[model samples]
Target: MGRGGGRGGGGGRLAFVVAMVVMTEMTWGLGDVHTSVATVAQLVEAEHAVIFALKDYVRKEESRLETIKRYIWGWQDGRADYVHNPINSYHFLRRLTHDFDSVRRALHHEDLTQALRANITSLRGGVEAAAEADVNGAAYSLVRLQDTYNLTVDELVEGDIRGTKAVQELSADDCFRLGQQSFNNLEFDLSDKWYQKGLELMEAKQPITHEEQLRIKRIKQQQEHRILMRQLVTNMAKQSDGQMLDRFSGLGIPISFQRQIYAQHKDVAQVEQLDDYYRRLCRGEQLQPPEAFVGLKCSYVFGKGGYRWLMPLKVELRWDDPLILVYHDVLSEAETELVKRISTPRLATTMVHSFTTHQARRSLARVGKTAWVRRGDDRTTDRILQRVEDMTGLATDTSEDFHVLNYGIGGHYDAHVDFFDLDEKSLDKSPHQGDRLATVLFYLNDVEAGGSTVFPMLGVEVPARRGSALFWFNMKRSGKGDYRTLHAACPVLLGEKWIANLWIHEWGQELRWPCTRDPED
Candidate 1:
């Protein structure tokens, strides 16, 4: 299972594609059958929907292709350095690259159904690999992908925004805040739109302050720079096909490189440079850092945690937040499949009790479902848990039951701490162990779009990777919930996100990691 094979032809994806096609055909046919004509706003709405839906997939396709191209060109390090499937990563990447090309072609077609079908077809290899590697999780993500694709198709065919509330309802501050958020997400067009809209909203409302005027001026200059930079990217991709050029335009490259050379035209030296550039971009390094660090004690350097367990593969240190280690193929395809299999049957919609409502409610902020895999309940999971304990140097019984979460579109947790507040009541009062001291998140599958575990205060965002683990301490050196750990699960814009969380308690591990009584440790 460790060695990758050709993409297996599975009935799972084909069946799903057929079902979605039929479902969407019926849903969208209603508009065409009727005499009602769609307004311009409807068309714009449909386009925006597609843009939001495909943003993540576009990000993934480019990132994976760049990574694979580097490896093929002998620039990338060993395979175990990143969290990826051993059985089908290369083949899946190859398939994704081709699929991306197909999508670009489909976008040119007049009939969007053709494009939607093409989009579903592109996922064939990925679906196969995902199903082969993680059965329950693969099915979960496939359904989510299909649903979003179908929705986009339906919107394109029959959807309308004519009757919806106008943008006039938004205040200047609302528009301003939204613009900032879009800018942070790298949606440049949307950011500019909101910024402009805020300026418009300012007219009927309060007078524009000096700061607001300066901000609007700066944003105008920045937007102009972005346009110039985009044009620079266009001139560089001289040899690329229209489809490939479209991708490069979206990649958000720096404008400083003035010369024109398509990606294919790069020499060995240029290839290395571009490889480094793409890697940094994919890791969110291009994202602007906040003005000040929130609650962070200090910056960290990457290194091993000095654990006793010996990993046969070359252990990689991908991050420095509390010794983040990524051991590839640590969980085999079979192991991942078994874990998902056990957890899926008991999956339940997670609920949070809001103090404002005083009632348990499902939140729009998060839509991920969860299930627990108790320790020693199954053979594969037992071994996995033992491995986890050894890896963390935590006592065998100190960790909580394995928590599997599935986050779909519009699913996110707003910026919040993971550790429970003693004084404040929790939303979901799940039966769990002591205060969470540390955590190890096993990224079950690579998300297609927007499922970054973002720590806004710390200015850190870790993309989820299959067969990889991200470990971090929830508490500071003084044994309190680190506000620096204030984080959120960004909304899944494109594909579903599957992850398993391992929470270690403060009940044990005195010998391994002793607590500090001092408040300012």
Candidate 2:
């Protein structure tokens, strides 16, 4: 079980060398595989893929190596950390050490194929033994094995040595340089290939240590996390409000908000009648906001600001009629419960930061968090738009547009105004017209402190509450602009919070809503 005895067979050593030379000749003869056809472009691509795979593998292997080494060293040094007496435990280590040695030998001889084959055999046995808990199974031997296998395959197929002299044959620096170039070009796939080849070379010379493996794993995890975030954002951009809300609900946060449905001038008469209409609208009855008047409100802040302050209220006048609604909460009890379930300390902070950074948006609208297209089929999002149309007594074909943003602690939208000013040429390529007219934001939960939607120039601080919404117009009725809509998410302090936003764009202006443009335009 120890490295005390060496294999005393010359036959084995001779066989290994012969196998290496034959394989090298075979690969080289595969039509300038190592030179003529080894264009920088093809080699670079292959090298990158190999590098990423090997980097991942090396990381895992290093972790297992650490565990095994620690145990062995501890036992040898008479440290209390080592546990003996279990024959199975010793057997596991024996196999693991053997595999390690095999890998070392293959690498030293520059024979990746043989090394990999031996490593895989050792790993399979090691994994099975570890799974059965017959040995010290705390080590993640399987992960290492899989990564190594993948890396070896990639390197074998893509690596090459070039130059007039053997001395200039593919150096480790050359492979790594190519890999770095691919990474710089955002060619992740290619970059990974080269890294793998470099790893193969390193492996042949010396195996990576445990600490190195840990560092590499963290790097890969970070990269993967970023990729996932980007994809999620892209998906969010394509969804309707209802769909977005439903997706948010699935993540365990619910939203509730109040919508203002203006009455038609002809439908208005006595003050009592107007009161009744308003009551009906609040009860979810069909009533539309007036076409002549615009509806506006303020939504919750994404992050917790440093200071607690009441939001400054403002009213915009159109023909002597005010069109904005201020102060409201956006979360339902069910939603609150869901938020409580999934709002972790780290997640809360991340959400809050994302919102404050303008990674999230807020708005007001009418709609259930979950819009169902068919029984058991959940897919509609324009419930707020439908409500607006119904209440206003307008007849435009309405569609749902919605979004759910998670604002954990420290969530803030840096400072941005939402308006799009794409030229005619750009408009032709856009999906939605530059028509974001108004925005509605609903605060799903309240933080213990901090969290406010701040308007710096106006010196206003709109606080967050359950079921409260803040609405505002980003675009004027004349299709012009309004500068007052510029806002930011203050930082969060304690407790977790949630919010849902709806950006109401003029028909065909959805594309513009998501883009940045001059508010004045």
Candidate 3:
């Protein structure tokens, strides 16, 4: 009986061995088995321990790949850092580590078939998820997958997971190329866009770590510097034009008169000296004691005594040493008469009150005093206005309206635009049917210390002179508008300053009074 039992056991063993061999062969033929039969059989002897080990390895690898896929999807969707959590291998590694532990436990239990199945399913699911995520705008998962694959392949090729240094160098080179392209296009806006893209690519590189973050920061700094330089160039060009205008034609007036005007205003000279002193201070020069009352004084007057009205004013004395550009003031004799006529006390009161109450009949009234002196029409305003008109045969008609405003120190007019839309009833009672043409401001008195008409848009400052006026236009000949007419009167620093303003309206056949086109025959 014992002999029979032994032979039966041997037969059973042989049968089991044969069945295992056939299964292995079939699996190998189907390319499902990664290990040789000998190796499989070796593990199988201990209840399929070898197969379990093989399954464990595959499962861990699949989980790692899955983790990589997730990271790539995150990056591509521009959400890798959306929540302040960067998509990186470490993130994948955390998931991979957990999956690896599970595989290890299954392998230790000798569940070879189940472990292998889990690994394959996990890998397939990860790939599918990666594909879906990409379609939905997630790219970080794919990037993670590729990185992991490369690392695994490297391990397979060289028995190490870390990739070659060349991979890092290549990535850096690509980033450098992108940065260069942005810098060269002079498209600072676009360059910033590309530089950010390059930064992500550099950060995505695996195994090869460098000072990529620092390098990216440096690149951004360089881009900012380029933008600032471009702005500086533009500003310099504008300043150059202004300087040219200031020098040759005395900003439209003769150079001699400009010089004389500057000489007469001692306060202007002192303010200029102060500006120079400040500039020197910026350059670390020993500062000299500043004079008393160096800057402008601004104020506003709501009303006084029976005239309950609002009139804003500013006064500032412009220094003369580095004389800024002053544009031409042009006016016509007829226009001048119109200005003087309006300066009468009754007219001035009516016009000022009308403007304050928003009852001015004409847009021109909104701009000038009823009686403005036509300084620009006289020889004293600027020689260039006549020269330009004569050379271009522009058929110029210039004029000025003078108003004597007495405001004490610390008076200022808030910044405001001079152009009033003819269509806006709130601006003037009887709005001009045509566009505003030009403006001429005559400085009727040299302010004691401060009183300069400032055009912030043009960055031009006009100092007050006893008879000189500053001129500009609000409209172009083509009917286009200009933003240059926006101006402000800075604060009065020391004493009172009187000014004459002139606003020219578009020419039409309609005269203020009934007159024939050819005048009296």
Candidate 4:
């Protein structure tokens, strides 16, 4: 009901419920949808992107239909007046010359529906691929966004979040389905809230019953009788028009108004839970930086290589405990755009390593799509890897492929450590490729709103800025995994988020960053 009403009004009780449940289901998955604001500038270069293709088709088709409809309707309504206009006359000739052939071919088809079917068939493969499991996924995402942002059901139904507007308002039926989803997930409190809002909407929109209509008629007659008696008692002047007298009569009928509710904005200090830090940081609230980073200053890094000596990287020392730094202007705009183009075609659902089994599998904790691009995939990719080596002074030979990720609305990754915790017998372990020693994450684009790389334990939040890369050591100098380096990607509230990750391994960095005898080093 977010976009459509009941499928068939007369379909009995069971059918009505089914329609309610299915109507609000989103047509496409959020991860598959691209934001125009984020990608419109790259339209000429990314012509191969499916979103661009579809958008082009839609615009051309719509414009053609509008032109045809307007020209035909205007001619039919007033041919003389329409043709008298020089602009209209010119368009008439233009349409005959340009659009006539396409119109004739469509009409000549044995069945007019075939033209539509042919177009749909051409896009069916992509449509089916993008829509798989979309209903359940979309419902889950909406609920997650609701809980994370503390948004009220009324606010969401009205198509507003904090001050950002949704594309459209959700219908009463949409509310019912949302409540049903929450109930299925065993979120009773959230379910109750949605149900209450749905009921309120249904009651407000309910039409007057036959009995109520009859009661109103009776009341009107009694009031008329009373008016006549008063007229006789006072001997009032008789008005020729009784309709005018009816204007002064007051009939008490109740009208309903929708309830407005706003989400409570709590102070960052009041939020003490670990998960709360992620939400607060994403909301742009200031958090206390770690004490170790109090005296850290911005500086320049020439790495320990001849290549970087001429072009030192602008760096910001953000954290000191686990050694986190942000390298500014490390990537050019052209390079970032090329990475997005290469990764778009290969994007797939992101998978997480299971704690119990250590198997890579999909989970609700992370909602995004990712694709891996090795150094040889393209010259641009190779250049990016070389730049990573120069910036971090770490070898890229033992590192994994560049993992490019794109996050959609409400997309996020729960708190996680980057390094693998495998033993000798573990099947996931590679003999030569050591644990993930460090991570250099490049922000391909700037997020309009809430996408930030956050370290909840250290109360640190690094915002996504285009052309910037955040680097951090995942393991300690003593060759042990650092628990304090736990981090997560906060949910994207608005716009799009694109990132390329280069995970440097410990195998080739023995001398560059040597291990220490003291565990605390």
Candidate 5:
């Protein structure tokens, strides 16, 4: 997958892309999605969640250490490196990174509720534990959002994301922690910016240590070195190949430069540009439209199907090239609730198809849970399929089961197409359902903040509106993938996001959505 938030096509050659994508996923197992906050609602409850999560871990560790002390006394009768083992070292690092930092903030918080403050005593005995990976993932999520959306650290501290504000703003301590984590992650620019913000905020309230001051200075020095190296590389790139080698002969410049260029090449410099547009679209910025789609308008249209006369679909032309349309009130409140109720019990952590391994695996690129709600699962789903057929004038028989998804904290699906263009072998393994011809995504709930579905190529953002459905063609009339439809789900930054996707296949749509030699269609 591309770090810009999209599933990269399968092929072992895209391994470099995997490295950048996997960095956001998790170092260990699939991370705890609940621990990360993508929206303002999650941010308001963050401190409370962090407190309860860390309490039990601290209590248990204390007990375990007491037991170890007794054992050490009985065995060695002296102190040694009792906590030197891998497990102890691991937990110790977790203490510094997760537990201690969280607890410190909780202790110093001025806005903690009376009930939560009272529970602080019980935390002295026992509480809950959050995973280490979850902690790191949560910290990095803010950094990811900042980078993707081009949000300022000040905006983040104020909890003002694109004019959507949270009840609580991040504190100076929070800024410091973000900076510390960014430094650990080697994001020097972000680390320096966050550190500067923290220092500015902390100056009047608390004294920063001399060591901390020195650390910031060291970070500045590192930044200078990095910029210098980049300039040198750029200058070297302009030199003739033979001259470049001769100028820096014994310095191993050729080998090092080749490695650097190769790394940059495989990471998809163009994909990075695609991501820039993707982020801008998600931020609801307007991009220059293709000349053909200059003045598209919203209108009501009834298809040529038998059900067309019953009611006209409220269609908003999102993108003319790929024929993206948004249908209003396609689902009812009752049907939406019923679908969610059926899916709730069946929901499990969703997985992305690994391009290299050709298997589904958990990834932060997609953070949420999904349930396969088949057509016959209930009358509601069956009715939904009928409605889909009515709206698109396509056969329902070849469509896949409804994929009901509920996003958790920081939930999102990176940019990807619904069609499995790279999985041709597996496509044959199953009954010939054919490639995904079109998709109808039914929004089950209204999002308070983020969670807009964005198309990077076309600069389109369709916000989630309950009962509304967004429809788009994934394959052209020629049965080839239409890359213009490449889209992604922006991370939910506030209230819950619930959606159901119905992917209509090409097999039975041939008669309805007939093929054409004109690929552009």
Candidate 6:
């Protein structure tokens, strides 16, 4: 999830099944979570705006990340070490070790915010001076610093489309796309309406092409498939009286995602095997290690920098897109239990917002409850935040309250971006706390199956592990959202999944790491 500010803004389960049925019908990643649907769909259909606005925004942000990488590469002491390593790979992690002491020093003083600001100021001066002296070297050294500095801003843009009065909205193709998405989500009635509308638009313009005819035929077939799926789900829900989802754990297929995946990847047979294996794992059946985990020995544990923060000594699991780090046992068992106990009473099913009105509502896209673990004056609570501060090196005061999430069987979150989008500075709709810069997530408990944090874009799956933390950036330095960060929380197939989230914000980091306009190397 992206960061949220105090901009405190802020759903149910048969009602939930129905919603999941709708989500199941949409194209997997396009509509994504409900929050961005209206905004993104609007972008796609809003005429000429589609070509330059959405696509260019994405391209520029991606290019910016690449340029920063090159700049930092010049700063590196040894470029040879990274010859075979992609910027997003684990080998690039070597560059991050150098920043540990510098970032930690900011934490040494009592006023963390000021200390960090001072350190960043000093460091920026040094870098700029070096840039003047050696030009390329300033850009080449310590890439982790560049990456961390940029990603530190959380959800900078909310992509709020509210009150967009003068712009053209939802075009014909947009309706068709939404239709396809709804079809994937299993909202047949809604999907059909959208498709029919698109068909009408096409007929109005000219005669339908043979391919268009085929599209209509395929959609009808998909509608039939949805009918079958609805029957199965309704029957299962009836049989168990909605009390036992565990039984369906063995069904091992992307029931809601089938049509959507079929449309995009067009490989139903391959999906079946994948679905079966995933389900088997969810059902708690043991299997041989996959290629990714082969020869993996993540047994060794070590510490680094001043905090000597605990992290897995192995580099078995890593990814770049938005740079993810999965560190095991970062939190002790007692620490985990302590936070859980404090948060149990506060748990409530998670909710999404109406982008325009900012009203809280529930939907199937996210099927869990969340509560905050505030930075209280209590020693344990304060220490928990302190540990988080040490882990991330950002001032806690500038960040949002710690969020504790709980997931039971069937709980899941769909693909979504964590950053908010801001444009023209006229849209004052960003969250009060500021955009999320980076996300620090600690897995408080292990699941018997499922509950893996899956990054679809980066092809990374990190299963929940007790006391382990998964850290990643939500935004790039320019504060633009990183599309590559799109991720989902897979349905909890077995035991409960517990996690803690700390959203470090751009507002807080501004004082520490100021932004620069020229992102080019």
Q: Considering summed lDDT, which 10 consecutive residues are worst modelled in model 6?
A: 151-160
Model 6: per-residue Cα lDDT over 159-256, one tens digit each: 11111111122335545554655454445555566666666665666577898778767766865776787678555554453235432232222344
TM-score of 6: 0.44
Higher-scoring candidate on TM-score, 2 or 3: 2
Q: Candidate 3, TM-score vs. the true structure?
A: 0.27
The 10-residue segment of model 4 with minimum total lDDT is: 252-261
Query: Candidate 6's error at 204, in angstroms?
Result: 53
lDDT of 1: 0.53
Off by over 4 Å in 4: 1-111, 123-125, 128-132, 208-272, 289-293, 305-307, 423-432
Query: What are the per-residue Cα lDDT tens digits for candidate 3 across 146-194?
Result: 2212223222212122222111122343334434543442233434444
lDDT of 6: 0.54
RMSD values for the candidates in order, in angstroms, are 23.5, 24.2, 26.0, 24.6, 21.5, 31.3
**Candidate 2 regions with alpha-carbon error over 4 angstroms:** 1-324, 327-331, 335-400, 422-431, 508-521
Give the worst 10-residue stretch by lDDT in candidate 2. Answer: 252-261
lDDT of 4 by residue, 446-509 (tens): 9876779999887788999999999999988777788889898987766668999988888878
lDDT of each: 0.53, 0.40, 0.40, 0.66, 0.67, 0.54
TM-score head-to-head 2 vs 6, winner: 6
Q: Arrange candidates by TM-score, highest first: which order? A: 4, 5, 6, 1, 2, 3
> Mind giving the per-residue lDDT tens digits that candidate 5 earns over 1-521?
23311221222223443453455456535666456566345434554544543454355445545544543343322332212221122223344455555454443322333465467556754533446665555555576567666788988887665665543456666676677666554455787788778767766454668876776567567656656765565565645464444443222122223344444456555666676777777777777646746678888788666566677788888777778999998888998899999999999878877544557767656877899898788877887788887778889787778898997445677777787664462463344388888899999988876788998877788999999999999998877788888898987665668999988887776678889999677
Least accurate 10 contiguous residues by lDDT in model 3: 133-142
Highest TM-score: which candidate?
4
- Per-residue error for 152 in candidate 1, Å, reads 13
